[model samples]
Target chain A: MPETPTIPDSPATAPLLRLSGLEQVFDTKRGKVPAVSGVDLKVEAGKVLCLVGESGCGKTTTARAAAGLTRPTGGSVEYLGHDIHRMGAAEWQEYREAVQYIHQDPYASLNPVRTVLSSLTAGLRKHKKVKGRHEARQAAARLLEQVELTPAESYLDKYPHQLSGGQRQRVAVARALAMNPKLLIADESTSMLDVSIRVSLLNTLGGLRDDLGVGFMFITHDLAVAKYFAWDGEIAVMYLGKVVEHGPTPQVINDPQHPYTKALIAAVCEPDPRLARSKKTIPLRSAEIPSLTALPSGCTFHPRCPLAESGDCDTTPPTLAPLDERRRLACHVVARDHVAAQAGTG
Target chain B: MSEEPILSVRDLRITYQTGRNSEVVAARDVEFDLYPGQSMALVGESGCGKTTLGLGLLRLLPKLGRIPQGEIVYRRKDGTTADILKMGKEELRRFRWSEAAMVFQGAMNAFNPVQRIGAHFADTLKDHLPEGKRLSKTEIRERSEELLRMVRLEPGRVLPSFPHELSGGMKQRALIALALALNPQVLVLDEPTTALDLLTQCSIVEELHRLRAEFGFTMIFITHDLGLAAELADRVSTMYAGRIIETGTAEDIFYDPRHPYTSGLINAVLPVVGDLPQLASIPGSPPSLATLPAGCAFGPRCEYVQDRCREAVPALEPLTDRPDGLTHATACLRAEDVQHSREVVSRA
Candidate 1:
C-alpha cells in the first residue's frame, strides 16, 4: 500500500474554498430539474479535492458553480471565508481574477484567429497594469516557459491549429496562469489529450501546487487518474448529484465503503492478462444511470445498488456521515452492516 | 501450429494522395495474423493509423486512400482464401458484412434517428441476406429481437422505440447487435466503449467476451486505451507512426515489453494498484507520415536511443532471450538492454 499523502489537519487555518449545501436546479419545459443538490466540500491552499462520477452526475455542474461560470440556485460558495456570490462589484471582479477555470476542449477554448502571444497578453493587459507593451510581451513569453513550452519565442507567433493537442492544452494552462489564480477548477482538462500526453499535463498541474500555492478541484470520470494525480488529496465519489463517498484518496480507493465505489473499482480495466482472463466479480449493477429528472424515491443509487434491501434502502435517503476516522459513506446497508459487525464482535 | 490463419496481413502499406504530387503513408509495412476465435487488439494514439489499418482489412478505405502494396488474405466461409484488396465490386459487397463486419467508432450516435431500433437491425439483415434466401418481415423481426436479447436488452421495450428514446449505452449495444446480425466470421470493433462510463464499459466488454465464445468469431478490437486492450485481447499490437512497433501475447506485452515506445506506453498509464509511480511520458509527438525521420520513427522520443538508431530502422524480429514457442517481437535496436534494465528495475 502506498503511504497516504500528508494533509493539513489543523482547524485554525481556514480553507481556501468552501462549498456548503450547494444546490443547482434548472427549469426545464417539464418542471424544475435538480442537477446538483445539498453538496458540501472544501479545498485548502495547495491541496487537491478530486470529484469523480459518471456523466450527468453533476460533477461538471459543481465545478462550473465553483468557478462562478454557472450560478447556483441555492446555498453559497465561500472563498476565503466570504460568500463570493454575495460580493460587491469590485470584490467580485477580484474574485473572478483569483479563481481560474480550465475546460475540457483545449481546441474550442482558445481563439483560433489569434496568436498565442496576443491571446495571453490580451487577458493579462485587461486584469493587470503593465509598465509597457514590451513588458507584457516578456510576461507572455515567461508564461509559455512556465508551461514548459520551450523557446517560448517560437510558440508566441504560432496559431492554435499549428500546435499538437497536448501543446494546445499547455497554452490553455498558460492562459489561466496569466491571472495568477489561487484556485483552479479543471473539468476533464486532460481527457482530450493522448494517454502519453496526459501525464505530462498532470505533472504541469502538479507543479502549480508547489510553485503557485493553488488549490485544485480536479473533476474527472476516470477513477485511476483520480487516484494517481490526487494521491495525497481527497477523493469524493458522486452518484446522481450527491457524493456517495468522500475521504482520503488511498482510503476511499483501496478500502471503499460504499457499494458504488466498490462497483467502480471492480469495473476498472486493469492492464493485466491473468486478471482479465480469470473469473473476477464484475459488479454490473444496472443497465444504465437513472434519469435525473425523475430520480428514485429514496437513495438515488438504490435502483442500481445490488446490496440494497427492500424496506430501508427504498424508503429512507442516507446522509453523508463519518463512518470512521478515515472516510465518510452515504449508504444505509453498509452502515447497518457495520453496526451489526461491531455488535457481534464487541 | 501450421493451421491456416483466419486473416493474414503482410507488408501492407496504405497511402493517402493529398494533392497533385504529395502522399501521406497512413500505414506502412504492417503485418499480423488473426486466428479463428482469437481476439487481437490494435492500439495507438490518435493519428497513429490503427483505424486506417482496421479500415484497410475491410477494404473500406476512403476515396483518397489506397493500398499501394501488400496482401490482406481473408479465409472465406467456404474454406477458400482470397486477397481482400483485389476483390471486385460485387464480390466485395458480398464479402463485406457476411464475412466481416465493423462497428465504427462513436457508433452510438450513428443510427438514423427517424427509424425505429428494430428497423436498423432489419435493414442490415435484409441487405446481407442471400438473394434466394430472403426472409419475411416477421422472421426478420424475430431474429432482430433474438439479437437484441443476446446483447442483454429487452426486445419488447427497445424494438418499438426510436433511436432518440434509448440511452447512449443502449444505442451502442444496439449497434453491436446490428454488427452481429449477420453472424460474421470476423467482427471488428473500433473504440466500442471509449466514451462510456466505467461500469457500462465493463458490462459491455463482459457481454462481448461471452458472445465471442458463444458465437466462435474472431475479433479485432481497436482503441487508444492500452488498459482496455489488455482486458479484451489475447494478442496485442502497439502501433506508432503508421507501423507496428511491437506485437506479442498480452502477458508478454504488458509485463515484459521490449521496445522503448511500448515500454513508454505501458509506463504512462496510471496504474490502479500499488504506489502512484512516476509516469514516464515519451517526450515528442508522433512523427508526421508525410515527413518521417531517416530511420526509427520513435527514435526522437526514445530514451535509449543511440547514433545507429537514428541511422538505421530496426525490423520487428523475434526475441531469442524469450522462451521458445512465444512469438514476441519488437522493432528496437537496444531491445536486449531495455529488457534487461526493466528486469533489474522490477526485481529491485
Candidate 2:
C-alpha cells in the first residue's frame, strides 16, 4: 500500500480556495437540472487542481462557482478559511479581485474594437496596480512579454481581430494576470485554439503558476493536457457533475481506482501510430452518456461502467472514499475488489 | 497497396475572393492520393487550407471561392476517372453524396433545430437517391434506423428527438450516421471530433475506422489535432500556409518528421509521459495568405531556416536518403538538418 500523500497537511497552512458539497441546479423548462452536485475541491497557492470530464460534466459549473461568477445553490466556497459568500463588501471585492477568470473563447472574451493595450491596462489601473498612464503602459507591455508575445510594443496596438488566435489568447492571459490574482479559473481556455498553439499557451500558464505562485482551477475535457500541465498538481475526474476520483496527478492518471477514471485514461489515443493501432477496441462500455436531467440511479456511471454489478451498482450510490491519503475513489466494484485482494493476501 | 488510387489530387489550387477584388490563395499546389479503405489526415493550424482542400475535392466551394488550377481526379465506381472540378452541376449533384460526402466541422450542432433526426436522414435520402430509384416511406424509415444503429445509436429513441434533445456526443454520432446514409465511397470529415470529448472522440474514431474497414471507403479526415489524426489515419500530411509541407506514413510522421513545421507540430503536443518540458511552440503566427512571405511560408517561424530557405520555395520531394527509401516527402530546404536535429525552439 503506497501511501505517500503529496499535499502537505498542517493547521498553520490553509488551502487558498475550498469548495465543500458544491451544487448548482438550474430550473429549466423540463424540470430541475443539476449541472453540478456534491463536488469538493481544494486549491492551495501555487498548486493547480484540474477538473477533468466530458461535456456537461459540470467542470465549467464548478469553475464558475469557485470564481464567484455564479453562486452555488447549495454548500459553500471558502477562501483562506472564510466563507466567500458571507464576506463583507470590502472583503468580497478583495476576493473577487484576487480571483480572476479566463474563458474558453479568447476571441469572444476580448473587446474587438479596443486595442490590446487598452484592455490590458484598464484592468491594471482598475486594480490600482499602477500609478499613472505611463506606468500602466509599461506594466501592460511587461504582462504581454510574460505571456511570450515578444517585443510587447508590436502587439500592444493591435486589436483582437488584427491578432491571430494564439496571440489573442496570450493577450487574454496578460489581462488575467493584470490583477496579480492568487487564483485563476480557466474553463477550457485553450480548447478553442489550434493544437500546436494550445501547448504553448499551457506552457505560459504553467510558468505563471511557477513564477507568480498562482493556483489554477483548469477545467477541461483534455486528460493529456491536464496531466501535462498539472504535473505537480492534482486531478479530479468528474462524471455528470460528481467527482468520481480525485488524487495526485500521477497517481490518478497512472493508477485510476475508479472505473470512469480508467475509461477516460484509456480513451486518450496515444500519438504513436503503432500504439494507437494496437488498441483496436475502445475501453468504454457504451457510447452514450446518460441524460443529466434523468441521471441513472445509484452510480451515475453504472450505465456505462463495465465492472458495474447490476444490483449493487444500480441501487447503492457509492460515495467518494479514501483509497489512501493521496487518492480517493467512488466506485462500488473498486472498493469490493480492493477489499477482496487485501483479504486474499492477509 | 493498390496501383490505382481511389482518388488523386494534383496541382490543386484554391483561392477565396475577398472584398475589393482581392484574392487569398487558400490552397496552392496541393497533391495527394487516397487509396481504397485508407484514411488520410490533413493536419494544420486554422486557415492552413485543410478544410479548403477537402471542400475543393467535393466541389462544394462557395461563390467567392475559385479553383483557378487543379485536377481532382476521383476514380468513379464504374472504373472511370473524372475531374470533379470540371463536372457539371447535375453531374456534381449526382456524384456528391453517392460518391464523396463531407461532414463539416461542428456539423453535429449544424442540424436543423426545428427538425427531428429522422427527418434530416429522410431529406438526404430523398435528395441523393439514384435516379428512377424511389423508396417508400417505410423503406426510408427502415434504412434510417439501420444507419442510426451503424453509428451505435438506437433509432427508436433518437429518430424522433430534436437536435437540441440530443447530447453533444449523441449529436456527433448522429451526424456520422447521416453522412454514411447515402453509402458514399469517399467521406471527407472536417474536424468531426475536434469539439468532442476524448472518450467520445475515441469511440467515434474507432467507429469510423471500423466503418471504413467494413465498407472499404476512402476517407479524408481533416483535423488540427495531430494526436487524433495519428490514431485514425494511415497517412498524414502537414499543411502550412496553403501548401502541403510534409507527407508520410503515420509512423514516419510521428517518429521521424522531416519538415520543421511537422516536427514543431508533433513536439508541441504535451507528452503523456515524462516530466513536463518547456513546450517548443513554432514562434510567430502564419503569414497572411494574400501576402505570404517569399520562399517558404514556414521560414519565418522555422528554427532551421537558412539563406537558401528564404530565397526560393523547396518543392515537396521524397527522402532518397532514407535506408528504406520510402516516399517520405518534405518541403523544407533543410530537411536533412531537421531530420538530424530535434525541436530546439523551446518557448520560455
Candidate 3:
C-alpha cells in the first residue's frame, strides 16, 4: 500500500537531475490519458541511465517532461534544485539547449535536402557561439571529426541520401554534440539501423560519457544493447507510464524482484539448444494492455500479474519497499519472502 | 536421409528492380532440396533473401520479382511431378496453400480482426474437404479444438475469441492451426517468431516442433537468428547478399562456420547468461547489391582475403574425401586454408 513514501535526504554524489512523482496526462475525447504517471528518476554526473520498456509505456513522455517540453499534470522534475514544470519560455529554451534530445529514425530527424555541414552549424550559429562562415566550417568539421566521420570533408559536402544509414546517424549525433550539452536523451536512436552498426554506435556513446563527462539518458527496448551500453548505472523499468521497478543493473537483471521484471528477464532469447532458457515463458497474453485514456485501477500492471488474485491487486498499489540498501521492488510477492521462496526454487 | 525427394528447387534466380537500369539480385542461382520428416533452416541477415527463397519455393515472389531461370519440381505422393513454375494461374492458385502452406511472422495483419479464429479454420476445411465426408457442427468443433490443442492452446478459448483478443504468440499458433487444416505435404514458416520476445518465441517454436513431430510434416524454417536456427533446424543454410554461402548440419554451421558473414554474425549476438566465451564481429556492413564487387562479395570485409581472391569469384567446391561431399559446398577458392585456420583457432 502507498501510505507515505519517506522523502530521503539526497545522496552526497551530485546527481544532475532528480525527478519525483512526475505525471503527464492528455485530455482526449474518451477520457484523460495519463501517459506518464508516478515516475521517480535520478541521474548522476557522467553516468548513462537507460529507461527501457516496450512501445507506448510512457518512457518517452517522461523524457519530454524532464526536458521541459511537455508540462506535467502532477509531480516535479528537479534539475539540481529548480523545478522544470515551473520554468518559463526563456528558461525552458535554456533547459532545452542544455538537455539535447536525439530521436529515433535518424533519416526523419535530419532534413532531407540540407547539407550535413549546414545542419551541424545551425545550433552553433543560432546560439551565437561561433563567428562567421569560415569559423562555422571549422567548428562543423571539428564536431564531425569527434563523431569519427573520418576526414570530415567527405561527410560535410554530402546530403542525407548520399550517406549510409550509419553515416546519417553519426551526423545526427554530431549535430547534437555541437551545443556541448549537459544531458543527452537518445530515444531509440540506433533501433532503425542495421544490426551490425548498433554496437559501434553504442561504443561511441560510452566513449562520450567517459571523455566529456556528459550525463546520458539512453532509451531502448533491446535489453542486450542496454546491458552492453550502461554497465553500472541504475536501470528504471517502466510499465504503463509508471516506474514499476528501479535498482542496480546487475541486481534487477539477475534476480528480478517484480513480476514484470521477471517476465522481461525470461524474454531474452536463448541461442543454445541443449540449454533451454526459452522453456519458462509465462503465457504473455494474460497481460491486458491498459488503454491510456482508461487507466487500470490500483497498480497499472496488477491486472496482468501472474501471481495476482481478485482483491489483492485490484485495491492496492504496492509501495517501493526496501529489499536492500541499493535495491527496491514494489510488489506484494516481494514483501513476503516466504511466498517468493516457494516460487523461486522452481 | 530420405531416398525420395519431396521438393527439389534447382538453379533458382530472383532479382529486385532497384532502379531504371539497375536490379538487385535478391536470390542468385540458388539450389536446395527438402524431403519429408525433417527441418531445414535458411538463415541470413535482414535483406539476405531467406524470405524470397521461401516465397520462391511456392512461386509466390512479389511484384517485379520472377523466377527467370529455374524449376521447382514437387514430386507428389502418387509419383506425378508438378513443376510449380510451369503452372498456369489457376493451377498455381490450386496448388499453392493446400499443397504447401506458410505461416507469416506477424499474425495481427495476417488474420481478419472481425472474424472469429474458428471461422478461419472452417473456411479452409470446407473449401478443401469433399461433400461425402461432410462433418456435423460438434465434429467440426472437435476437429478445430484438436488443432488448437496441438499448438498447446485451449480450443474453446481461442475458438470463440476474435483475433484482437489473443496475444501475438496465440495468434501465430492459430495461424499454424489454419496452415495444418488441409495437412499439406510440406510446411514453410517464414520468420514465424520474429516480433515476439524470447520466451514467447520459444513457446511458439516448441509448438511448431511438436506439431511437426506428431504430424510428420516436412519443414523449411526461415529465420535470421543463428541461435534460434541452430536450436530448431536439423540442417542449416546461411545466405548473404542473395547467395547461399554455406549449407551443413547445425553443428557445422554454428560450431564450425565456413563463411565470414556467418562467423561474424555468430560472434556478434551477445549470449543471454553464464560465462560464454568472447565473440568477435566483422567491422563493416553488408555490401550493396547494386554495386557488387568484381570477384567475391565478402572479400572486402574478410580477414582471410588473398591476392587470388580479387581476380576471380571462387565456385562452391565440396571437401572431396568427406561424407556427403556432394551435399556440402562453400564458395571459397581457398576452402582448405579456411578450414585449416578454423581448426587451429578451435584448438586454441
Candidate 4:
C-alpha cells in the first residue's frame, strides 16, 4: 500500500500551492448550480500538476478559478500558503503577474492586430518592470529564445496570421513566459492541433519545466501525452466536478483503480487490433452524461457506474483512500474488505 | 469484391481556380469504390481535398469549380452508371439524399436552429420520397420518432425540441436521423464527431456502429483523427496533400501501417486509455497542395526517404507480400521495408 503524500515529504520539497474542498456554484437559469465540488489539488514550486478530464468535467472551470478568471463560490485556492481568492489589490496584481494562463486557441487568445514582439513585451512594460523600449525588446527576444523561436528578431515583427500553427503556439508560450510567471495553467492547449506538431509542442513544455524551474498546471484530455510528457509529478483525474482518482502518473495511468478511469483506458485506441478486440469496450452506458445541474443523489458517478448495478454503490460517496503505497482512488468499488472477501484470498 | 459498386469514382480531379493567376489542385486523380454495405474512411488533414472529393461526387462543388477530369461512375441498380459530373443540377438534385446524402461535420449549425427537428425530417421526406407514393404527416412523425430512438435520444423530446435545446451530440444524432429518413444507400459524412468531447465522441462512435448495423448503407466518413478512424472504419483510406496515399483494413493501418505519413499520424497520437503513453509526434507541417514538391510530398519528413523519392512520385501499390498473404496496400516506395521493420524492442 502506498503511503499518503505529506507536504514535507513532497518529492520536490514542499507543496507550493495547497487547495482543499473547492466548491464553486453558479446561479444558472434553473437554480444555483455547483460547477465544481469537493476538489482538492496541490502543485509544488517546480512540478507539473495536470488536471485532466473531459469537457464540462469542471477542469476548465477549476483552471479559471485558479487563474482568477472565475470567482469561486466556496473553497480555498492557496499559493504559498496565501488564499488567492481573498488576496488584496496589490497581492492580486502579483498573482496576476505570477499565474499566467495559456488558453486552447492560440490565435483567438492573442491580439490579431498586434505584432508578436509587442505582445511579448507589453506585460513587462505594463508592470513597469523593464526600463526602456530597447530593454523590453531585449527581454522579449530572450523570452522568445527560451521557447526555441530562434531568430526571435524575425518572429517579432510578424502578425499571428503570418506564423504557422506551431509557431503561433510557441509565440503564445513566449508571451506567457514574458510575465516571468511562477506557474502556467495550460487548458486544452494542444487539443485543437495537428498530431505531428503536437509532439514538438509538448517537448517544448517539458523543456520549460526542466530548464527553468517553472511550476505548471498542464490541463488536457489526452492521457497518453501525460505519460511521456516528461512530467515527473503526480496527477489528479476529475469527474463531474470531483477528483475521483489521483496519484503518481504511472499508477493512475497504468493500473487505474476507478471504473471511470478503467473506461477511459479501455476506450483508448490500441495499435494492435488483437488487444482492442480482447479488451471489453466500456459499453456505451449513456447517450448523455448525467447533467451537472441535477447530480445523482449519492456519488456523482454512481448513476453511470457498472458497479452500482451490483448494488455495490450508493448515494454516500466514498472518501479518497490509499489502495497501494503510491496511489489512491475515490470509489466504493475499490474498498479493501469488499475486494478481499470477493477474491476469497483474505 | 462485388460485381458492381453503388458509387465508383476514378481519376476524379477538381481544381479550384483560387485567383486569375493561381489554381489550387483540390483533388488529384482520386479513385475509390463504395460497394453496398461497405464503408470507407476518407482520412486526411485540413485542405487535403477530402471535402472537395465529397462535393464533386454530390455535384455540390463551389460555383467556381467543376470536375475538370475523370469519371464519377455510380453503378445504379438497373445495371447502368450515372455520370454525376455530367448530370444537370436538377437531375443531381433529384438524386440528392435519396440515392446519396451527406451528414456534415457540425450537425448543430446544419440543422435549422429556429425550427424543431421533426420538421427537418418532414422536409427531407417531402423532398426525396416519390410524391405520388408517400406516407402521411402522422406517419412521417412516427418515422422521425423512430429515427431519433435509433440514435438513443428520446424520440418525443428530440422531435419537439429545437437544435439549440439539444447538445452537440444530440444534434449530430438528429442530423444522422434526418439523413437516414431518405434511406440512401451511401452516406458522405465529414468529421461528424470531430467537434464533440471524448465522452460524447464515444457515444457518437456507438451511434455510428448502431447506424452501420441498422442500415447496411456504405459510408465515406472523412476526418483527420486516425484514432477515431481506427474505431469507425471498415476499410481506411489515408489522404495527404490531395490524394489517397494508403488504403487497407483497420488492422493493417493500425498494427502494420505502410505509409510514412500514416505511421507518423499513428505515432503522434497520445495514448487515450489509462495512463497516456508518450507521443512521438513528427516535427514538420503538412505541405501546401498548391505548391507540393515534384516527387513524394512526404519526402521532406520521411525517415527512410531515398533519392528516387525526391524525383518520382510513387503511386500507391499493394504491399510487397504478407508471409501468409494478407491483404493491404500502400503508396510509398519503402512500404515493404517498413512492413518488415518492427516498431521497437518491447521491454516486456
Best by TM-score: 1
| DockQ in order | 0.53, 0.47, 0.26, 0.46
lDDT of 4 by residue, B254-338 (tens): 7778898888787776654433444566656878777898788888888879999998888878774532112477889998767
Q: What's the DockQ of model 4?
A: 0.46
Worst 10 residues of 2 chain B by lDDT: B339-348
Question: Which candidate comes out best when scored by lDDT?
Answer: 1
- In candidate 2 the C-alpha lDDT for residue A275 amounts to 64
Better of 1 and 4 by TM-score: 1
lDDT measured at residue A277 in model 3 versus the true structure, 0 to 100 = 26
In candidate 1, what are the lDDT values of residues A1-346, reduced to their tens digit?
A: 1212134234356588877788999999988779999888889889999999999999999998898888899877877776788889998888888889998999999999999998888877876655578998899999999899999999999999999999999999999889888998899999888989899999999999878888999999988889977888999999888989999999988888898998888777767666566625546468689888889988888888889888878888899888888688899999888989989999
Model 1 — TM-score against the truth?
Answer: 0.95
Better of 1 and 2 by DockQ: 1
Interface RMSD of 3: 5.0
Winner by DockQ between candidate 3 and candidate 2: 2
Tens-place lDDT digits, model 2, residues A1-346:
1222344334257689988889999999989999998887899999999999988889988998899989899978988767789999999988988899998998899999989999998877776879997898899999999999989999988899998888898899899888889999998888888777787788889899999999999988888789888879999999999999999999887677887887777777666676666654436667778878899999989888888888889998888888777888899889888889989999
Model 3: colliding residue pairs: none
Q: Which stretches of candidate 3 lie over 4 Å from their true place?
A: A1-14, A276-314, A338-346, B18-22, B111-171, B197-199, B275-279, B319-329, B333-348
| Candidate with best DockQ | 1
Which CAPRI quality tier does the interface of model 1 achieve? medium
DockQ-wise, the better of 1 and 3 is 1
Model 1 chain A poorest 10 in a row by lDDT: A1-10
lDDT of 2 by residue, B21-97 (tens): 78899999988777777788999999899988888889888889999998988897788899898888878887888
lDDT of 3 at A110: 94
